[model samples]
Target chain A: MEDTNSTIYALKTSAGQERNVARLLARKARTIDGIGISSILVPESLKGYILVESSTKIDLRNPDLKVQHLRGVVEGSVGITFDEVKRFLKPEPIISSIQKGSIVELISGPFKGERAKVVRIDESREEVVLELIEAAVPIPVTVKADQIRIIQKEAD
Target chain B: MKACTVCKMISSKDHCPSCGNPTSDNWSGLLIITDPEESRVAKELNIEIPGEYCLRVR
Candidate 1:
Protein backbone atom coordinates (compact mmCIF):
# COMPACT_ATOMS: atom_id res chain seq x y z
CA MET A 1 0.00 0.00 0.00
CA GLU A 2 1.32 3.39 -0.98
CA ASP A 3 0.84 6.32 1.32
CA THR A 4 1.03 9.88 0.16
CA ASN A 5 3.49 10.98 2.82
CA SER A 6 5.69 7.99 3.59
CA THR A 7 7.64 5.37 1.63
CA ILE A 8 8.92 1.89 2.43
CA TYR A 9 12.68 1.40 1.97
CA ALA A 10 14.60 -1.87 2.19
CA LEU A 11 17.80 -1.94 4.24
CA LYS A 12 20.47 -4.55 3.60
CA THR A 13 21.73 -6.07 6.83
CA SER A 14 24.24 -8.76 7.72
CA ALA A 15 22.85 -12.28 7.61
CA GLY A 16 21.38 -13.41 10.96
CA GLN A 17 21.51 -9.81 12.25
CA GLU A 18 18.31 -8.39 10.76
CA ARG A 19 16.65 -8.21 14.16
CA ASN A 20 19.65 -6.52 15.77
CA VAL A 21 19.90 -3.91 13.05
CA ALA A 22 16.19 -3.21 13.22
CA ARG A 23 16.29 -2.89 17.00
CA LEU A 24 19.35 -0.63 16.95
CA LEU A 25 17.85 1.46 14.14
CA ALA A 26 14.63 1.87 16.07
CA ARG A 27 16.52 2.98 19.16
CA LYS A 28 18.63 5.40 17.15
CA ALA A 29 15.66 6.77 15.22
CA ARG A 30 14.03 7.76 18.48
CA THR A 31 17.06 9.67 19.75
CA ILE A 32 18.18 11.36 16.53
CA ASP A 33 16.43 14.42 15.17
CA GLY A 34 15.15 14.60 11.58
CA ILE A 35 15.21 10.79 11.23
CA GLY A 36 11.57 10.07 10.36
CA ILE A 37 11.63 6.30 10.66
CA SER A 38 8.09 5.09 11.21
CA SER A 39 8.46 1.33 11.49
CA ILE A 40 10.91 -1.57 11.12
CA LEU A 41 10.06 -5.06 9.87
CA VAL A 42 12.24 -8.15 10.25
CA PRO A 43 10.45 -10.95 8.40
CA GLU A 44 11.81 -14.39 9.27
CA SER A 45 11.55 -15.49 5.63
CA LEU A 46 13.58 -12.55 4.40
CA LYS A 47 17.04 -12.87 5.87
CA GLY A 48 19.81 -10.28 5.63
CA TYR A 49 17.24 -7.54 5.00
CA ILE A 50 14.77 -5.40 6.88
CA LEU A 51 12.09 -3.06 5.64
CA VAL A 52 11.89 0.46 7.06
CA GLU A 53 8.99 2.89 6.65
CA SER A 54 9.94 6.52 6.68
CA SER A 55 8.78 9.85 5.35
CA THR A 56 12.15 10.38 3.70
CA LYS A 57 15.19 8.29 2.82
CA ILE A 58 17.05 7.23 5.95
CA ASP A 59 20.53 8.67 6.31
CA LEU A 60 22.69 5.86 7.70
CA ARG A 61 25.75 8.16 7.65
CA ASN A 62 24.57 9.79 10.87
CA PRO A 63 26.98 8.33 13.45
CA ASP A 64 24.20 7.94 15.99
CA LEU A 65 22.34 5.45 13.77
CA LYS A 66 25.30 3.54 12.38
CA VAL A 67 24.20 0.07 13.33
CA GLN A 68 26.99 -2.52 13.46
CA HIS A 69 25.44 -5.12 11.11
CA LEU A 70 23.73 -2.70 8.77
CA ARG A 71 25.20 -2.92 5.30
CA GLY A 72 23.25 -0.10 3.61
CA VAL A 73 19.92 0.78 2.05
CA VAL A 74 18.95 -1.22 -1.07
CA GLU A 75 19.78 0.69 -4.22
CA GLY A 76 16.54 1.70 -5.88
CA SER A 77 14.72 4.96 -6.38
CA VAL A 78 11.37 3.21 -6.17
CA GLY A 79 10.37 2.07 -2.71
CA ILE A 80 8.83 -1.35 -2.01
CA THR A 81 5.08 -1.64 -2.20
CA PHE A 82 2.91 -2.85 0.63
CA ASP A 83 1.52 -5.59 -1.62
CA GLU A 84 5.01 -6.97 -2.12
CA VAL A 85 5.53 -7.26 1.63
CA LYS A 86 2.04 -8.40 2.54
CA ARG A 87 2.84 -12.12 2.25
CA PHE A 88 5.40 -11.86 5.04
CA LEU A 89 3.02 -9.92 7.29
CA LYS A 90 0.58 -12.76 7.85
CA PRO A 91 2.20 -16.13 7.25
CA GLU A 92 0.04 -19.06 6.23
CA PRO A 93 -0.18 -22.16 8.38
CA ILE A 94 2.62 -24.62 7.63
CA ILE A 95 0.22 -27.55 7.60
CA SER A 96 -1.92 -26.20 4.78
CA SER A 97 0.63 -26.92 2.08
CA ILE A 98 1.63 -30.40 3.25
CA GLN A 99 -0.11 -33.26 1.42
CA LYS A 100 -0.26 -36.99 1.82
CA GLY A 101 2.41 -38.93 -0.16
CA SER A 102 4.68 -35.87 -0.14
CA ILE A 103 8.31 -36.53 0.69
CA VAL A 104 9.52 -34.65 3.77
CA GLU A 105 12.52 -34.39 6.01
CA LEU A 106 12.06 -34.42 9.74
CA ILE A 107 13.36 -31.14 11.13
CA SER A 108 12.99 -31.79 14.86
CA GLY A 109 12.56 -34.45 17.50
CA PRO A 110 14.04 -38.01 17.63
CA PHE A 111 13.62 -38.60 13.90
CA LYS A 112 15.39 -35.36 12.97
CA GLY A 113 17.09 -35.29 9.55
CA GLU A 114 15.38 -38.47 8.40
CA ARG A 115 13.54 -38.52 5.09
CA ALA A 116 9.98 -39.78 5.24
CA LYS A 117 6.91 -40.16 3.09
CA VAL A 118 3.68 -38.53 4.24
CA VAL A 119 1.01 -41.20 4.76
CA ARG A 120 -1.86 -39.32 6.38
CA ILE A 121 -2.63 -35.76 7.47
CA ASP A 122 -4.71 -34.72 10.44
CA GLU A 123 -5.59 -31.16 9.53
CA SER A 124 -7.46 -30.41 12.74
CA ARG A 125 -4.59 -31.49 14.92
CA GLU A 126 -1.88 -30.28 12.51
CA GLU A 127 -0.14 -33.64 12.65
CA VAL A 128 1.09 -35.98 9.96
CA VAL A 129 1.74 -39.70 9.82
CA LEU A 130 5.01 -40.43 8.06
CA GLU A 131 6.78 -43.64 7.05
CA LEU A 132 10.54 -43.59 7.25
CA ILE A 133 11.98 -43.97 3.76
CA GLU A 134 15.18 -45.68 4.90
CA ALA A 135 13.73 -47.99 7.53
CA ALA A 136 13.75 -51.73 6.85
CA VAL A 137 10.23 -52.10 8.22
CA PRO A 138 7.55 -49.65 7.11
CA ILE A 139 6.70 -48.21 10.49
CA PRO A 140 4.24 -45.33 10.62
CA VAL A 141 5.47 -42.43 12.74
CA THR A 142 3.37 -39.48 13.84
CA VAL A 143 4.84 -36.00 14.04
CA LYS A 144 3.72 -32.42 14.22
CA ALA A 145 3.33 -30.83 10.81
CA ASP A 146 5.89 -28.19 11.65
CA GLN A 147 8.47 -30.84 12.50
CA ILE A 148 8.86 -31.79 8.86
CA ARG A 149 9.84 -29.81 5.79
CA ILE A 150 8.40 -30.82 2.44
CA ILE A 151 11.06 -32.23 0.15
CA GLN A 152 8.91 -33.25 -2.79
CA LYS A 153 5.22 -33.40 -3.69
CA GLU A 154 3.50 -36.56 -4.84
CA ALA A 155 3.17 -36.78 -8.58
CA ASP A 156 -0.30 -36.35 -10.02
CA MET B 1 9.59 -14.04 25.55
CA LYS B 2 5.81 -14.21 25.43
CA ALA B 3 3.37 -12.43 23.11
CA CYS B 4 -0.02 -11.11 24.03
CA THR B 5 -2.81 -12.94 22.28
CA VAL B 6 -4.90 -9.82 21.87
CA CYS B 7 -2.27 -7.31 20.77
CA LYS B 8 0.60 -9.61 19.83
CA MET B 9 3.07 -7.43 21.67
CA ILE B 10 6.15 -9.25 22.86
CA SER B 11 6.96 -9.06 26.55
CA SER B 12 8.54 -11.04 29.36
CA LYS B 13 5.55 -11.04 31.69
CA ASP B 14 2.55 -13.36 31.55
CA HIS B 15 0.18 -10.51 30.81
CA CYS B 16 0.72 -7.88 28.20
CA PRO B 17 2.06 -4.63 29.59
CA SER B 18 -0.18 -2.50 27.35
CA CYS B 19 -3.32 -4.62 27.03
CA GLY B 20 -3.12 -6.86 30.09
CA ASN B 21 -4.03 -9.83 27.87
CA PRO B 22 -2.57 -13.26 28.48
CA THR B 23 0.67 -13.87 26.59
CA SER B 24 1.84 -17.02 24.84
CA ASP B 25 5.38 -18.17 24.27
CA ASN B 26 4.44 -19.55 20.84
CA TRP B 27 4.80 -16.56 18.62
CA SER B 28 6.83 -15.70 15.53
CA GLY B 29 8.06 -12.79 13.40
CA LEU B 30 9.38 -9.50 14.81
CA LEU B 31 7.78 -6.15 13.98
CA ILE B 32 8.91 -2.89 15.56
CA ILE B 33 6.75 0.18 15.26
CA THR B 34 8.47 3.43 16.05
CA ASP B 35 5.77 5.83 14.85
CA PRO B 36 2.24 4.49 14.86
CA GLU B 37 0.70 7.59 13.35
CA GLU B 38 3.06 7.91 10.40
CA SER B 39 3.66 4.24 9.74
CA ARG B 40 1.65 2.61 6.98
CA VAL B 41 2.95 -0.79 7.95
CA ALA B 42 1.68 -0.31 11.47
CA LYS B 43 -1.62 0.95 10.12
CA GLU B 44 -2.06 -2.13 7.94
CA LEU B 45 -1.40 -4.38 10.92
CA ASN B 46 -3.69 -2.24 13.12
CA ILE B 47 -0.90 -1.69 15.64
CA GLU B 48 -1.18 1.55 17.63
CA ILE B 49 1.51 1.26 20.27
CA PRO B 50 5.15 1.65 19.32
CA GLY B 51 6.97 -1.43 20.55
CA GLU B 52 8.06 -4.98 19.76
CA TYR B 53 5.31 -7.19 18.31
CA CYS B 54 4.90 -10.62 16.77
CA LEU B 55 3.22 -11.29 13.45
CA ARG B 56 1.66 -14.53 14.58
CA VAL B 57 0.70 -15.76 18.05
CA ARG B 58 -0.55 -19.24 18.81
Candidate 2:
Protein backbone atom coordinates (compact mmCIF):
# COMPACT_ATOMS: atom_id res chain seq x y z
CA MET A 1 0.00 0.00 0.00
CA GLU A 2 1.16 3.54 -0.79
CA ASP A 3 1.75 5.91 2.10
CA THR A 4 -1.03 8.45 2.50
CA ASN A 5 1.49 11.24 3.04
CA SER A 6 3.18 10.54 -0.26
CA THR A 7 1.48 12.96 -2.63
CA ILE A 8 1.03 13.05 -6.38
CA TYR A 9 0.61 16.24 -8.41
CA ALA A 10 0.22 17.67 -11.88
CA LEU A 11 2.04 20.62 -13.47
CA LYS A 12 -0.21 22.10 -16.11
CA THR A 13 1.95 23.46 -18.89
CA SER A 14 1.55 24.57 -22.46
CA ALA A 15 1.08 21.84 -25.03
CA GLY A 16 4.68 21.75 -26.21
CA GLN A 17 6.36 22.46 -22.88
CA GLU A 18 5.75 19.13 -21.12
CA ARG A 19 9.25 17.77 -21.68
CA ASN A 20 10.97 20.98 -20.55
CA VAL A 21 8.79 21.46 -17.49
CA ALA A 22 9.14 17.82 -16.49
CA ARG A 23 12.92 18.10 -16.54
CA LEU A 24 12.83 21.19 -14.34
CA LEU A 25 10.32 19.70 -11.87
CA ALA A 26 12.39 16.53 -11.64
CA ARG A 27 15.41 18.59 -10.68
CA LYS A 28 13.49 20.74 -8.18
CA ALA A 29 11.60 17.86 -6.53
CA ARG A 30 14.83 16.00 -5.75
CA THR A 31 15.92 18.92 -3.55
CA ILE A 32 13.02 18.39 -1.15
CA ASP A 33 12.51 15.33 1.07
CA GLY A 34 9.13 13.65 1.51
CA ILE A 35 8.68 14.57 -2.16
CA GLY A 36 8.93 12.53 -5.33
CA ILE A 37 8.22 13.07 -9.02
CA SER A 38 6.94 10.06 -10.90
CA SER A 39 5.59 9.57 -14.40
CA ILE A 40 4.07 12.34 -16.56
CA LEU A 41 0.94 11.82 -18.64
CA VAL A 42 -0.28 14.06 -21.45
CA PRO A 43 -3.59 12.74 -22.71
CA GLU A 44 -4.61 13.50 -26.23
CA SER A 45 -7.93 14.88 -25.04
CA LEU A 46 -6.40 17.04 -22.32
CA LYS A 47 -5.00 20.23 -23.86
CA GLY A 48 -2.75 21.03 -20.87
CA TYR A 49 -1.59 19.45 -17.59
CA ILE A 50 1.50 17.30 -17.07
CA LEU A 51 0.77 14.80 -14.31
CA VAL A 52 3.51 14.46 -11.66
CA GLU A 53 3.97 12.48 -8.43
CA SER A 54 5.32 14.28 -5.37
CA SER A 55 5.83 13.07 -1.82
CA THR A 56 4.56 16.32 -0.26
CA LYS A 57 2.08 19.08 -0.97
CA ILE A 58 3.47 21.57 -3.49
CA ASP A 59 3.26 25.29 -2.87
CA LEU A 60 1.91 26.89 -6.01
CA ARG A 61 0.92 30.25 -4.45
CA ASN A 62 4.08 31.96 -5.60
CA PRO A 63 3.19 31.25 -9.20
CA ASP A 64 5.74 33.71 -10.47
CA LEU A 65 8.60 32.21 -8.49
CA LYS A 66 7.45 28.77 -7.45
CA VAL A 67 5.78 27.67 -10.67
CA GLN A 68 6.15 30.58 -13.10
CA HIS A 69 9.85 29.86 -13.54
CA LEU A 70 8.97 26.46 -14.89
CA ARG A 71 5.93 28.07 -16.46
CA GLY A 72 8.18 30.49 -18.26
CA VAL A 73 10.05 27.58 -19.71
CA VAL A 74 6.77 25.84 -20.46
CA GLU A 75 3.75 28.18 -20.16
CA GLY A 76 1.83 27.77 -16.86
CA SER A 77 1.54 25.21 -14.10
CA VAL A 78 -1.31 24.27 -11.78
CA GLY A 79 0.06 22.41 -8.82
CA ILE A 80 -1.95 19.29 -7.97
CA THR A 81 -1.27 16.43 -5.56
CA PHE A 82 -1.25 12.61 -5.86
CA ASP A 83 -4.92 12.05 -5.11
CA GLU A 84 -5.65 14.45 -7.92
CA VAL A 85 -3.33 12.51 -10.19
CA LYS A 86 -5.19 9.25 -9.43
CA ARG A 87 -8.08 10.61 -11.43
CA PHE A 88 -5.65 10.34 -14.31
CA LEU A 89 -3.14 7.53 -13.61
CA LYS A 90 -5.43 5.00 -11.98
CA PRO A 91 -3.39 2.02 -10.72
CA GLU A 92 -5.58 -1.08 -10.67
CA PRO A 93 -5.23 -4.06 -8.41
CA ILE A 94 -3.35 -7.14 -9.59
CA ILE A 95 -6.24 -9.38 -8.52
CA SER A 96 -9.93 -8.86 -8.87
CA SER A 97 -11.83 -8.27 -5.66
CA ILE A 98 -14.88 -9.82 -7.32
CA GLN A 99 -15.72 -12.92 -9.33
CA LYS A 100 -15.10 -13.33 -13.07
CA GLY A 101 -17.68 -12.10 -15.60
CA SER A 102 -18.69 -9.45 -13.11
CA ILE A 103 -19.57 -5.94 -14.19
CA VAL A 104 -17.14 -3.24 -13.01
CA GLU A 105 -17.47 0.48 -13.57
CA LEU A 106 -14.93 2.19 -15.73
CA ILE A 107 -13.29 4.82 -13.55
CA SER A 108 -11.24 6.52 -16.26
CA GLY A 109 -10.84 6.50 -20.02
CA PRO A 110 -13.15 7.22 -22.97
CA PHE A 111 -15.66 4.82 -21.42
CA LYS A 112 -15.74 6.34 -17.97
CA GLY A 113 -18.61 5.22 -15.76
CA GLU A 114 -19.55 2.51 -18.20
CA ARG A 115 -19.98 -0.98 -16.75
CA ALA A 116 -18.24 -3.87 -18.47
CA LYS A 117 -17.87 -7.61 -17.93
CA VAL A 118 -14.57 -9.12 -16.77
CA VAL A 119 -13.47 -11.28 -19.62
CA ARG A 120 -9.95 -11.85 -18.38
CA ILE A 121 -7.48 -10.71 -15.77
CA ASP A 122 -3.84 -10.10 -16.65
CA GLU A 123 -2.19 -10.74 -13.31
CA SER A 124 1.26 -9.77 -14.51
CA ARG A 125 0.18 -6.43 -15.97
CA GLU A 126 -2.57 -5.80 -13.43
CA GLU A 127 -4.99 -5.16 -16.25
CA VAL A 128 -8.60 -6.33 -16.47
CA VAL A 129 -10.07 -7.91 -19.56
CA LEU A 130 -13.41 -6.30 -20.19
CA GLU A 131 -16.28 -6.74 -22.62
CA LEU A 132 -18.01 -3.46 -23.41
CA ILE A 133 -21.62 -3.16 -22.33
CA GLU A 134 -23.05 -1.99 -25.65
CA ALA A 135 -20.54 -3.06 -28.21
CA ALA A 136 -21.52 -5.13 -31.22
CA VAL A 137 -18.07 -6.69 -31.30
CA PRO A 138 -17.05 -9.49 -28.96
CA ILE A 139 -13.48 -8.38 -28.47
CA PRO A 140 -12.34 -8.25 -24.85
CA VAL A 141 -10.96 -4.83 -23.88
CA THR A 142 -8.00 -4.83 -21.53
CA VAL A 143 -8.10 -1.86 -19.16
CA LYS A 144 -6.11 -0.92 -16.10
CA ALA A 145 -7.95 -2.02 -12.95
CA ASP A 146 -6.97 1.16 -11.10
CA GLN A 147 -8.99 3.17 -13.62
CA ILE A 148 -12.18 1.49 -12.49
CA ARG A 149 -14.37 1.21 -9.43
CA ILE A 150 -16.32 -1.98 -8.88
CA ILE A 151 -19.98 -1.07 -8.81
CA GLN A 152 -21.53 -4.53 -8.29
CA LYS A 153 -20.08 -7.95 -7.72
CA GLU A 154 -21.20 -10.83 -9.91
CA ALA A 155 -22.26 -14.11 -8.27
CA ASP A 156 -19.96 -17.08 -8.73
CA MET B 1 14.21 -28.81 -4.89
CA LYS B 2 17.20 -26.71 -3.77
CA ALA B 3 17.76 -23.12 -2.65
CA CYS B 4 20.59 -21.05 -4.07
CA THR B 5 23.03 -20.04 -1.32
CA VAL B 6 23.91 -16.78 -3.05
CA CYS B 7 20.66 -15.28 -4.47
CA LYS B 8 18.33 -18.10 -3.42
CA MET B 9 17.35 -19.10 -6.93
CA ILE B 10 15.60 -22.51 -6.83
CA SER B 11 16.82 -25.40 -8.96
CA SER B 12 16.26 -29.21 -9.05
CA LYS B 13 19.38 -30.36 -10.95
CA ASP B 14 21.53 -31.72 -8.04
CA HIS B 15 24.87 -31.66 -6.13
CA CYS B 16 24.39 -28.10 -4.80
CA PRO B 17 25.11 -26.89 -8.33
CA SER B 18 23.86 -24.13 -10.71
CA CYS B 19 23.72 -21.57 -7.86
CA GLY B 20 25.96 -23.52 -5.41
CA ASN B 21 23.33 -24.35 -2.73
CA PRO B 22 21.82 -27.60 -1.47
CA THR B 23 18.32 -28.35 -2.77
CA SER B 24 15.40 -27.89 -0.41
CA ASP B 25 11.68 -28.53 -0.96
CA ASN B 26 10.70 -25.87 1.56
CA TRP B 27 9.46 -23.16 -0.83
CA SER B 28 6.12 -21.41 -1.00
CA GLY B 29 4.09 -18.88 -3.00
CA LEU B 30 3.94 -19.45 -6.73
CA LEU B 31 4.99 -16.34 -8.64
CA ILE B 32 3.96 -16.61 -12.26
CA ILE B 33 6.36 -14.79 -14.54
CA THR B 34 5.32 -14.47 -18.19
CA ASP B 35 7.31 -11.50 -19.39
CA PRO B 36 10.54 -10.56 -17.67
CA GLU B 37 11.37 -7.55 -19.82
CA GLU B 38 8.41 -5.40 -18.79
CA SER B 39 7.87 -6.97 -15.35
CA ARG B 40 9.39 -4.85 -12.57
CA VAL B 41 8.91 -7.68 -10.06
CA ALA B 42 10.72 -10.16 -12.29
CA LYS B 43 13.60 -7.73 -12.81
CA GLU B 44 13.75 -6.85 -9.12
CA LEU B 45 13.63 -10.54 -8.17
CA ASN B 46 16.37 -11.26 -10.75
CA ILE B 47 14.40 -14.14 -12.35
CA GLU B 48 15.60 -14.91 -15.87
CA ILE B 49 13.88 -18.28 -16.16
CA PRO B 50 10.27 -17.97 -17.40
CA GLY B 51 8.09 -20.05 -15.03
CA GLU B 52 6.66 -20.26 -11.53
CA TYR B 53 8.78 -18.69 -8.74
CA CYS B 54 8.80 -19.14 -5.00
CA LEU B 55 7.97 -15.85 -3.33
CA ARG B 56 8.62 -16.81 0.34
CA VAL B 57 10.70 -19.47 2.07
CA ARG B 58 10.91 -20.60 5.66
What interface root-mean-square deviation (Å) does model 1 yield? 1.4
Where is model 1 more than 4 Å wrong at Cα? Answer: A1-4
Q: Which residue runs of candidate 2 sit more than 4 Å off their true CA positions? A: A1-94, B1-58
Every model: iRMSD: 1.4, 14.2
Cα deviation of B23 in candidate 1 (Å)? 2.3
Indicate the residue-level lDDT of A95 in model 1: 88
Evaluate candidate 2 and give its CAPRI docking class based on DockQ: incorrect
- Deviation from native of the Cα of residue A57 in model 2, angstroms: 24
Give me the TM-scores of chain B across the candidates. 0.94, 0.56
Write one digit per residue (lDDT tens) for candidate 2, span A1-156.
332233334456766655456555544544544333333344333455555433444556533225432443222465444345333332233364755777788888888877788877776666788988877777777887667777767855
Q: What is the lDDT of residue A104 in candidate 2?
A: 85
Give each candidate's fraction of reference contacts reproduced: 0.87, 0.00
Give the TM-score of each candidate: 0.91, 0.31
Residue A17 alpha-carbon offset, candidate 2, angstroms: 27
lDDT for each residue of candidate 1 in A24-127, tens digit (9 for 90 to 100): 98997787777889889988778899998888777778776688989988977667878887888899878899988999999999999999999999988779
